[model samples]
Target chain A: MIPPRFHGVALAAGSAAGAVALAILGLWCAGFAPLAVITTWCAGAFGNGTRIALSLQEAGPLLLTGLATALAFRCGVLNVGGEGQFLAGAALFTAAALVLPVVGFALPLALGLGAAAGAAWAAIAAGLARWRGVPVVLSTILLNIIAVAVLGALVEGPLRDPATTAPQSALVADVFHLPVLVAGTRLHLGIVLAFVLAGVVWLVHERTSLGFEAKVIGLNPAAALRVGMPVAARQMQLLVASGAIAGLAGAAQVAGVTHFLSAATTSYGYAGIVVALLGRLHPVGIAAAALFMGLLDTGGRACEKQLGVPHELGDVVKGVMVLGVLIAAAWAARRSAAAHQGPADG
Target chain B: MAELVSGVAQSALTAAVPLLLAGTGELVAERAGVLNIGLEGLILAGCIGGFAGAVLGGTAGGLWLGVGGAVVAGMLVAGIFAVAVVYARVDQIVAGMAVNLLAFGAAGTIWHALQDAGRDSLPSGAGFDRIALGGPIVFDQYGLGWLALALVAVTGWMLAKTRAGLVLRALGEAPEACAVAGIDVLRWRFAAVLACGALAGLAGAYLSIMRTHSFAPDMSGGLGFLVLALVIFGRWRIGGLVVGCLGFGLIDAVQQQLQGAGAAGAVSYRLFQALPYLAALFALAVFRGRGNGPAQLGRPWPEER
Candidate 1:
C-alpha cells in the first residue's frame, strides 16, 4: 500500500497531468499543432535569458499576492479583496508620490503607506464581518468594485499624467523606482524581495508559535474560542496582514514594472487567488506555483505572438488547474480520512 | 427637468429588471445555503449563447431562441458548480472563483475569435420594443421588464408561503436534521443552483438581446456581484431585493446621465459610477437587524454518520 503522503502527492501529480492533457486537447481541437504550441510556450517562458527575466517579472507581484492569500487562507479567513487591496495600495502610493519629496527613503515610506491603505481597506470588510454579520466574501467583492471606481476617479482627476493622453498616473521619480538586479534583463529588486518575503513567510508559518495558534484557529474556530483564544481578533489580524501583503504587491508593480498607476494592474490580484490555491497554502509551494503561473503568463503572450492563440487561453488553463487542485486535495483528504478508520471498523 | 426625471426613471426601471431577475434567483440559492460566486461567469456564458442564438435565429424567432439558449448555458455552468460544491464538497468560495475565471477567459477568447472570424459588430437585432405608456407614471419599458416584475411577485410568494420553500430553507439551516427527515439536501441544493443559473442566464439575455442589443466581453461588468450585494441588502426577501435593485438601477442611470450631460466635468464620472457599490458596503456596515443568511450558509455538510 502507498504511504499516505505519497498517495496525496501522486493524486496531485495526476490531477496536474490531467489538466495539462485537457489543455493540450483543447489546443489540438482548435486546429493548432499541439507539440509546436507547447514548444513555443516553453521557449517563451524559459528558453532564454530574456524569457526567464520576463517570467520572473510576471511572478514578482504574483508571489507577494499569493503569499497574501495563502496567509489569510491559513488563518481560515478568505480575503477575496486582494484586488481591492492592491488597488488601494497603488492608489495610495501614487497619492504619496504626488505629495512627498521624491528623494532619500521616500519610496519605502510611500510603499508602507500603500500597504497601510490596503490593510485599512481590508479592515472595513473585516470590521463589518465581525460586528454586523456581513460575510467577508460579499463585502470584499463590493470593496473591489468600489476600489476600482475610486482608483479610476483618482487617476483621471488628481493623479492624471498631464504629459500623456492615456489614462494613467504621472510617473514617480527615477530614484523611487526599484533598481534592476540583473543587467540586460528587466529583473528588478522586487523579485529578490519576493523570494526573501517567501522565506520569511515560510519561517513564520512553520517555525513560530503564532503560526501554531493560527493553525488551530483555522482548523476549528469554535474549539479555539472554547480554549480561550481570540478567534475574531486573530481573523481580523490575518485579514489585515493579508491585505498589506497584497498592497505591497501593488507597490512592487508600480516600483518595478509599470512605474505608473493604471487599470492594467488589476488582473494580478485575481490571478494570485488562483496561485495561492495551486500552491496548497504553503509559502515554498507558493513560490514555485507563482513561477509556474508566471511562465504561463509569458507563454500565453508568446502563443498570441507566434501561434495566433489568444493569450486568454493561459488564464483558462490556470482556472482549470485551480479546479483540478481543489478536486485532488478533496479526494486526498477523503482518502486519508477513510484510511484512518479501517473497513472492519465500519 | 420633468422630462429628465421621467427619462431617468425609465432607464432606471430598464436597468433594474436584469438585477431583479438575477438577484431574485440568487436569493433562492442563498436561501438553500449555496453562495454562488460563479453567478458572474454563468451570466457571461449566457451572454455569448444568447447573442449567438439571436444572430442565428434572426427576426422571426430570435429573441425566444436567444433566451432559451441562455437558460441552457447558464444551467450547464451551474451544473458543474453544483457537482463540485454539493457532491464533492469543495470549498464554495474557491469553486466559485474558479468558475468565474474560467468563464471570463473562455468568453473573452471566444469573443475575440468571433471578431477574428468577421462577425465584428453585427447590427443590433430587433430587440424588445418599448410598450406605449400614456404618461410618466406608466413604465414605457420592454416586455422583459414586466416579466421580471411578475417573476419577483412569484418568487416572493413561493419563498414566503410554500412547503417546498420551507423544506429548502430547512435544508440550509440544518442539513443533518433534514437528511434525517429523509430529504435529499444535495439534490435540492443542486436544483437551487440550476434555477439560479437559469435566471442569471435570462438576465444576461436581457442585457444583450433586450437591453444593449449586442454582446461584449465581460459586459456583465461585475453586475453579478452587484446582484449578490442586492441579495444581502434586501435581506433575502423579494420585496427588499426589488427595492435594492431599483435603488442601484437609479444610481447607475443617474451616473450615465451625468456622463451624457457632461456635467461630471472635473468630478470624475467613476466616482458616480462607483456610488452603488460604495453604498452597498456602507449599508452593510450601518444596517443592524437580523442577518438574512441561513445558519449553515457556507459550511460544508458534515460527514455521513
Candidate 2:
C-alpha cells in the first residue's frame, strides 16, 4: 500500500503529466508548432535576463495573491474576493500616493493602507456571512463586480490622467515607487517582501495556534466548535487575512510595476486562485506555482511575436491546466480508495 | 414622454428576458442540489455557436439553427462540469471558474480566427420579427421575448406541480433519503445541470440573434453572473425570479437611457453599471432568511457503495 505521505505527491505528478499532455494537444490543434511553442515559451519566460526579470515581476504579485487564496482555502473558505481586495488595495494605495508627501516611508505606508483597505473590503463579505445567511461565495463575486465599478468611476472621473486620453489614473511621482533591486531590469523590493510573507505564512501554518484553529474549523466547523474553537471568528479572520494578502499583491503591482492605478492593475487576482489550487494550498508549493505561472504569462506574450498566437491563449492554457490537475487529483483519490478497500473485500 | 416611456418599457422587457430565462434554469439546478456557477461560460459558448450557426445557415431558418447550436455548445460545456462535479467530486467553485476562463479564451480565439477569415464586421442577419401588441413603441417585441416568458411559466409549473418536481426537491434536501427511495441522485443532478445549460444557451442565442443581431467577444459581459444574483434575489422561487429579473432589467434600461442621454454627468456611467451588483448585495443582505434554498444546495452526493 502507498503511504499517506506519498499520496499527495502522486496526485501532483499525475496532474502535471495530464496538464502537459493537454497543453501540447491544444497547441497542435491551434496549428502551431508544438515543439517550437515550448522552446519559445521557455525562451520568453526565462532564457534571458529581461525575460527572467519580467517573470519575477509577474511572480511578485502572484506570490502574495496565491498565498492569499491558499490561506483561505486551507481554512475551508472559498474567498473569491481576492480580485476585489486586490483592486481595493491598489485604489487605496493610489489614493494615498496622491495625498501623502513623497517620503521614504510613504511607499510602505501606502502598502499598509492598501492591505487595510483590502481587509476592509473583504470584511464586508465576512460580516454578511456572519450576520446574514448570505454565502461568502455569492457576496464575494458580487463585491468583485462592485469593485470593478468603483475602479471605473475613479479612473474615468477623479483619477483620470490629464495627459492621456485613456481612462487611467495619474502616475505617482517616481519617489513613491519601490526601489529597484536589480539595475537594468524591473525587479523590485516587492519580490523580497513576497518571499518574506511566504515564510511567515509557512511558519504560521506550521507553528501557530491560530493556524491550527483555522485548519480545524475548515475541516469540520461543528467539531471545531465542539472542541472550543471560535469557528466563526477564525473563518472571518482567515478571509480578512486572505484579503490583506491580496491587497498587498495589488499594492505591489501599482508601486513596483505600474506606478499608476487602472482597471488592469489587479488582473492577477483570479490567476492567483488558480496558482493556489495548483500548489495544493501549501505555502512553499504556492510560491513555486506562482513563479511557474509567472513564466507562462511572460511566455504567452512572447507567443504573439514568435508564433502569431494570441496572448490570450495563455489564459486557455492556465484554465485547462487547472482543470486537468483537479480531474487527475480526483482520479488518484478514487483509485487509491479502491485499492485500499480491495483486501477488505477479499 | 409617452414614446420615451414605451421605449424604456420595451427595452426593460428585452433586457429582462435573458436574465429570467437563465435564472429560471439555475433555479431548477439549485433545486436538484447542484450549483452550476459556470453559467457564464455556457452562455458565451452559446453566443459563439448561435452566431456561427446563423451566419452559415442563412437568415430564413438560421436564427433557430443558431439557437440549437448554442444549446449544443452549452450542453457540451456543462457536461464537462457535470462529470467533474458529480462523478469526480471536484470543487464546484473551482470547476465553474475554470470553465469560465476556458470559455473566455476559446470564444476569443474563435472570434479572432473568424476575423482572420475576412468576416471582421458583425454578421448581418434577420432577427425575430417584432410583434406589436398595442403600439409600435409600447408592445413591439422580438418573438424570443415572448418565448422567454413562456419558458418561465413552464419552468414554474414543472417545478411546483409535477411528480418529478417532488423527487428533485427531495433529492436536493436529502440525497441519502432519496437514494434510499431508489432515486439516482447523480443522474438527476446531471440532468438538472444540462437543463440549466440549455436554458442559459437559449438566453445567449437570444442576445446575439434578437437583441444585437451581431456577435462580439465577451458580449455576455457578466450577464451570467447577474443571472446568478437574480436567482438569489428571487429566493430560488420562479415567481419571485420574474419580479427580480424585471426590477433589475428596469434599472439596466434606465442606466442605459441615462447614459445615452448624457445625463449621468459627474456620477459617471460606471457608477450606474455598479448599481445592479450593489443592488444584488443589498437585496441579499436585507432579505437574508426570508426564502431558503434547498438544504444541500452545493454538497456533492457521496457515492453509494
TM-score of each: 0.95, 0.95
Scoring each candidate complex against the real one, what DockQ results? 0.71, 0.70
Which residue pairs collide, candidate 2?
none
Report the Cα lDDT for residue A59, model 2: 91
- Mind giving the per-residue lDDT tens digits that candidate 2 earns over B232-304? 7777888889999999889989988988887788587878888888888888889767447888888888842
lDDT scores in order: 0.83, 0.83
Candidate 1 per-residue lDDT, tens place, B193-223, comes to: 9999898888888887778777887688888
Q: Is the docking of candidate 1 incorrect, acceptable, medium or high quality?
A: medium
lDDT of 2 by residue, A164-230 (tens): 9788899988877888887787789999999999999999998999888878887788899999998
TM-score of model 2 (CA atoms): 0.95
Residue lDDT tens for model 1, A3-102: 8556544554565567667877988998999899889989999999889999999999999999999888888898889999999988898778778986
Q: Name the 10 consecutive residues with the lowest summed lDDT in model 1 chain A.
A: A4-13
